[model samples]
Target: MASVLGPLQPIVDMVTSPLFLQIVLFPGLTSIAIIGALLGWLERKLTARVQLRVGPLYASPAGGILQMFADLIKLAFKELFVPENSDAFFFIMAPTTGLVLGAALVGLIPFAPGLQIANIEVGLPAFLAIITLSPTLILLAGWSANSKFPFIGGLRALFQQTAYEIPLWLSALGVIMMAGTLNLAQIVAAQSTGWFIIPQALGAFIFLVTSVAEMERLPFDLPEAESEIMMGWQAEYTGVLFLAAQGPGFVKLYAFSALFSVMYLGGFLGPGFLPPLFWMLLKTLIIIVLIMLLRSTFPRVRLDQLLRAGWTTLLTLAILNIGITYLLVVGLPTL
Candidate 1:
């Protein structure tokens, strides 16, 4: 038995290495994808209940929890169709780019105490930069289609993300100011005294709204408005191509929810009864539910209204929050 197992031991050791486990298992790509799928079902179930309909129930006999996995399999087997006029290379490359960048953002987030992939000093900025990658991919996805509606939707994506990103970065600056560090794990530790939400409520609100726009979620989902633009930027995608384009959006939703929990909700810091990961996940789930509720609750905003809110309302509030946070950080020490 020892001789038989000897040859495979190195492979097993490599698979069980700390770096490999952190990158592939807990708080990694697989975990994020699984959680994203589960959240998708939860979103559907919640929206259905709101609309007085019963959501997925037959596929697995357990309220159709397996629906997402089944759908992924179906999409994987279906033919990928690229439009005759489309730029085949970029049309294929765009979604792959988005998925990779979105997953990269997960690597920056700390799941629990001593459970982060990398502990860079500039973790927050690294995260923000990785998030900004999506809009460029969105533009590519739309442009590669070589169609009018997709072109327009891609422009809208650029405009919307640009408008919101400033507020998102500035709002995060408020937390950074309070915490006095750009390291995410350190920021969570700072919150051992108190969560940033209490002092930076306005900034937190701005971050939440802008993140919705960044993710192109409901009420701010102008880039993919099905009724207005016929699936918009994703119109030319089919099968696994469609999945590649759409999967990142849900992953970003989960990523941003976790970001919010870590930044403003004290992250993994919580009561002793549960593991830190559990507390972190609970906070993130609450944010996810709140985000999903907006899907069925509100009508999509007009482009002008959406842009105006981002430029005028959110930006102004974010700036004010920064000033206020600066003052509290500077003044509170004297008392």
Candidate 2:
């Protein structure tokens, strides 16, 4: 028996390795999917509370916590409907692309020490590049539908992402300057002295606001404004394709929130009470709750207003943040 099992030892070790666990279990697809589903239910429940109504109670006995999973199951079994004149290839590819990119971005994020899938040197730039793919995929999704509303929605998405991505990149320069490395782990390590949120408050604010826009949530959800555009670029998708398209947004929300925690909230650096991963997760949940609250409390803004704010207000703030960071790092020498 020992001789027979000796040859399989390497395979067993490979399967149970930390890297494999990181990729398949915690801080990976399974965890992200669970979190996304819970967030969906949480958003509805919280919003319903604010609106003074019961929401999704019939889906499960436990305050409708299982509603999102139920919906996903229903969607998976439902018939897939393709538009008659739509470009079938792009239509199918669009959502798949978004889901892939979203997962890739999540994989890059370091949840805790030695717990990341990728720890590239140019992580920040690579992250920004991956985020830019979302808008392009949205455009493809809308245009491939060959419908009026979806096309309009795609154009709006393109414009919105283009406007906000500038400030998003500029805002992170403050952290990059202070940390002096694009590697996320190094950035977190540098925050041992203090979290960047203190001195880089302006940049942090810009990042928070632009992250909302990046995820296309609440007030920034002009592209998918259901009241005005009838679900916008997602109008033509059904069944699994719809899941592939819409599911990534929630995952991206989690990814962005985690990124925010890492960049500004000091990643996993905390008192040694629970664990590094626990602290990271706790901070992420707090940010997620804040975002959900924003969703529940705020109304969607007009496209023009969104554009103007992104271009003028956000851009100016990002510039000021960069200047302030430069002054502090260069003049003070202690930052």
Candidate 3:
């Protein structure tokens, strides 16, 4: 068979490899696209129900489950044109790269035993570092439009990310201190006695807040405020470019929610009767719902107010949480 197959054998072997499946199928491009689409429908359905209305219908016969797919198709089909004198190369590439980075964040997350796409030792920090690049890309996308509104939006993106990013890192700092490991899988292992949420409740709150801000959910959605900035950084984007601009948020939502589950809720740990994957997924879904609910209820905040909260209030809380963590580690070394 080897003699007959020759060069084709290695291609088959590569296709069959678990690494390929992990990257191209489960936790990579295909899964990210599907999950991001489904999550869009979920968010709409959840918000609609909360506000007492039928959300998406007619896209799919069953509960409009295919609405997002329909929307994606529509977006792809729409005609679009680039602004004159704009840096068209970056105007198109930035959002596409942001979507890829969003999927890459999921690559580091452990969904179940033996299910991680890349179980790097510094998975936690690497995830943060990769995601931080997203806003920079957004800034690039906005600036590349070569228009007044987008330039302002681009500046806002830079400022907003700069404000919340530190608190985000500090919030996770307590997790690192408690778990005493940078590897996400090992962090889950450290929660064998109890979840980090109990001791690091304050940090978890800061994380939840910062995560919502980082994802630019309402109240934190100043950069692209539809009512104010006419969609802000994405004003000039249309058709597939528009799709690229919008898609990353949902992907990031899934990745960030999964990361929260891993860091606080214990990645895939659960009762013997329930599969590890089930628990991980259920937790991730719950966090996703909570984020959607927040979107529906939280008032849009001013950029200055949001920045102040991030730098002063959230920063102080994050620092205080770290101090508490130090005391706990000193008093209860076994924990």
The residue-by-residue lDDT of candidate 2 on 138-185, one tens digit each, is 999999999999999899999998779999999999999999999998
lDDT over C-alpha atoms for residue 249 of model 2:
84
Name the regions of candidate 2 deviating beyond 4 angstroms: 1-11, 332-335
lDDT of each: 0.89, 0.90, 0.92
lDDT for model 1, on a 0 to 1 scale?
0.89
Q: Which predicted model would earn the best lDDT?
A: 3
Q: Which one wins by TM-score: 2 or 3?
A: 3
Q: Candidate 3 lDDT, tens digit per residue, 222-308? A: 779888888889999999999999999999999999999999998899898999999999999999998999999888988888889
Ranking of all predicted structures according to TM-score, beginning with the best and ending with the worst: 3, 1, 2
Candidate 1 stretches greater than 4 Å from native:
1-9, 332-335
**Candidate 1 global TM-score:** 0.95
Where is the poorest 10-residue window by lDDT in model 1?
1-10
